[model samples]
Target chain A: MITTSALQVRFGDTTALHPLDLDLPGERIYGLLGRNGAGKTTLLSVLAGFRKPSAGAVLFDGAPVFENVRSTSRICLIRDDGMVGDGTDNLRDVLDMAAMLRPAFDSGYAAELLDRFGLTRKQRLGALSRGQRSAFAIVVGLASRAPLTMFDEAHLGMDAANRQLFHDELLRDYLAHPRTFVLSTHLIEEQSPLFEQVLILHEGRLLLQSDLDELRERGVSVTGPAQVVDDFVYGLKVLSERTLGPTKQVTVFGGLDDERRALAGRYALELGPVAVQDLFIHLTGGVP
Target chain B: MRRFPIARFLLSTHLPFLVMVLAGSYLLVAVILGVAVLVSGPASVSAVDVAGQVLHWLAVGYGYGAPALLATVVVHGRTRREFVAQHPVYQLVAAVVLAALITGVYAAEAALYSAAGWTQAMQPDRPFAAGDYPMIFLANVSMLSIALVTGSFAGVAVYRRDGAGALALVPAAGLLVYGGAVHGFFSLPFAQQGLPMAVTLPAVAAGWVLLWACAREVPLGNRVPA
Candidate 1:
């Protein structure tokens, strides 16, 4: 398990991440959702011990992680731009180096992932296309088999088909070996199904942390005559609204209890589950 | 084994390459000089001393190679953190290893010169006969160690200061003054192998300490304070 207590990151006067606390249980998949500059990457870096926090501590199993060989060796952070190797390094060299450095690394599995990604072992990573680089990074992250692995916008360069392939490979690998995985991505709708829990960040502060299903359940949209919709959403939390002629649709917080459902039925109004993407946009002020 | 992975990685990866390049370049120069002497005769090659040429090249190699190697490993994503974690001790070990390698190469060059019956024109004023090679090797190794450590210090200064022009000039100016002193001092008729060690070892120790200070607060990705 990883626990962060009052962690903060600041670059000069600009606060990248405000003081925040988080506890990540092991053997689970966490989806870290945020728009641009939402402190997702900063938080992940701090956890991985790649960047030191300005204040507070990040502990793994009750011990500090930064500069601790025992802790950092078990954590892996894969960035999207491929930060690990130089241009002259081939996939084979990279895998060999990883095997030597990462205690839990599996060479056979790494070879399998190389083949699955259609990357030749002898090919230089610098020569690969952007999508190929992303695939190679994903392969390294999965193959390292670190107990705590974090991926920060790791699939932004991949195409749709490759992205799907990555998701499939990730799920398959996680089922095979249970570990902590924190995936920070903006593709909320496409990846939310794989998340057991979700953490939302807005403007350098955490907005919410809840179960995936519970977060979705918290949003409900009511559509009906303009006056009825306005009256029903009144005295409740309204996220967004749209109007057409005499009709209105308002997305709001709080699940509809049976009484409100019956009231909707009596008013001849339509109710629907809010899309996770729409809910994210509403919460983050349409940053994405 | 796990305690000093930075030192191990650097020794495994960078040292071998540097050694190969140094030895190969020296041998190539030696072979070319041998061929030219054979073609033109010993009198024509009177001014061209192969042993002195090799020492000159070795000096150049350590002065530049040490800094480049450190910069490359420190910026690399895989090795940077470990490099920082195991710092001053790693550099001390690196200095000794690099010096030993250069000394070994010089020994091989001397043996090859003796077997080939090549004339060593620029004889030292010190007691440096074939039997006294160890003393001569120690003297040369001390100078090279000083050069390498100084270069490593300048490299970290440049890294911490974000490649500022002033810090980049540190290595160039240092090398110039040191090289000038080596030339001027050794040109004296009474110079011996013992004096250079006195100057070189203290400079090396100071340089190592400065390098540690320069590297203490360096963040990942070589970021400077805003």
Candidate 2:
């Protein structure tokens, strides 16, 4: 179990992560999505114990994680560029060191992942392709089996097909072993289904961190006569509204109640579910 | 009982030892080969003489590489920055302890050479100046200081989000200045062993080291290299 309480991360004059609290427990996927500079990486760093929060603290199983080897050794963080081992380009040496340092390291799984990705253990990482390097990072994160694992931009340099493969492999591994997995990505549409909870960061602040299913339920477009739709939204929180021909469609925050659904049915108003991307666009106020 | 011993975590960082040992051995081997092939005039040297030269200078150069190698091993890990912040005091102490080991080994050898006439047959007059003998000591201290500075600098720089570039550049930059100054002003004539030079230069190395160390105040995790 892992939790961050009032964690604030600042770099130089820019505050990368605003004060926020979060809980990521065992055996589920948590998806983190944000616009550029939304502090997703900063938040993950705190949780993984690779960074200390300017304020607040991250706890693992009721113990503070910062500078605690027991806590950190149990967490694996896979970054976008695949970390270089103290600036050394010897990929095998890095892997060997990782295998040596990490108690739970699954050498077989790491080797298998490397093989599946068509990467030789002997090839120097500097000479490898970007996708291969990202693949190497993914292999380390997954195979390390650190109780709490996060993949930040793990999909970097991955082709569409390879991305899908990574997703499938990650889910399979998680289901079989059942540990924490936080996936941060810009390709939200492809990965949203894999997350039970979604965190949307906005400008160093958490605009939203809640259930993905609840978020999905919040996105309903009700279409009807302009006057009828307007009347229906009188007491509801509207996210967006548009008109087509003589009809109007309004998106609202709360799901329609039984009474409202009945009214829409009787008045011949159409109500349909909107996908996560559109919901995200509404939540972050960013263009879809 | 505390989960990880300071000694264990301290020792775990020296995995680079294997790599460095191999490098040091290769360098020693090349030196032996070069000396054997080239250190000849009207007559060639004997095996014992060759061994004497190789072991002597190696004992001499051991201090130079020891400190840097120890620091490189001590202040290194999965990431450069993590290596430093994990145990700043512990790492420094370990590097100094390893430096002492290199010197201790050489001191023991120096005593053995003096007690026994083994080296006398090879050369009644050693091939080094009196100043050169002390230079080994200077080399050890400066090398260790230089290593700690450069290693710490690289670690701190990597924390600033330019880890790869900084790691590559830190050693080169530090050595460029240190080596340049040593070559130029190390043993200038007509002075009290350039007392100010020794004091000021090591201080400069320490200053460069502390500057990056101040930068080491950064907080980052594996998820965020920054």
- For candidate 2 chain B, which ten residues in a row score worst on lDDT? B68-77
For residue B140, give model 2's deviation from the true position in Å: 4.0
> How do the predictions measure up, each by TM-score?
0.78, 0.66
Tell me how many residue pairs clash in candidate 1.
0
Docking quality level of the chain pair in candidate 2:
incorrect
| Cα lDDT of model 1 by residue, A1-288, tens digit | 999899999988989889888888999999999888898988887787766799989999888887676787788888756545655778887777677667788899989988988899999977888778878888888887888888887886778988898889889999999998999988888888889999998778989988888888988989999999999888887887889999998888779889999999999999987667778887788633
lDDT of each: 0.69, 0.62
The digit string of per-residue lDDT tens for model 2 on A137-238 reads 788788888778888898788788778778888988998888989899988889998999988888888888778888888868888999988987788777
Fnat of candidate 2: 0.10
- Report the number of the highest-lDDT candidate: 1
What C-alpha root-mean-square deviation, in Å, does candidate 1 show against the real structure? 5.4
Candidate 2 lDDT, tens digit per residue, B79-108?
323444433444344445544544444454
DockQ of all predictions against the true structure, Cα-based:
0.19, 0.14
Residues B1-226, candidate 1: write the lDDT tens digits: 2556556765676567666876676677667766876897542221223344345445444544333333333222234446544544544465456556655655665566567675443444432444345655554555455555566566666655465425645654564345324422245432343465565556666766666555544545421211
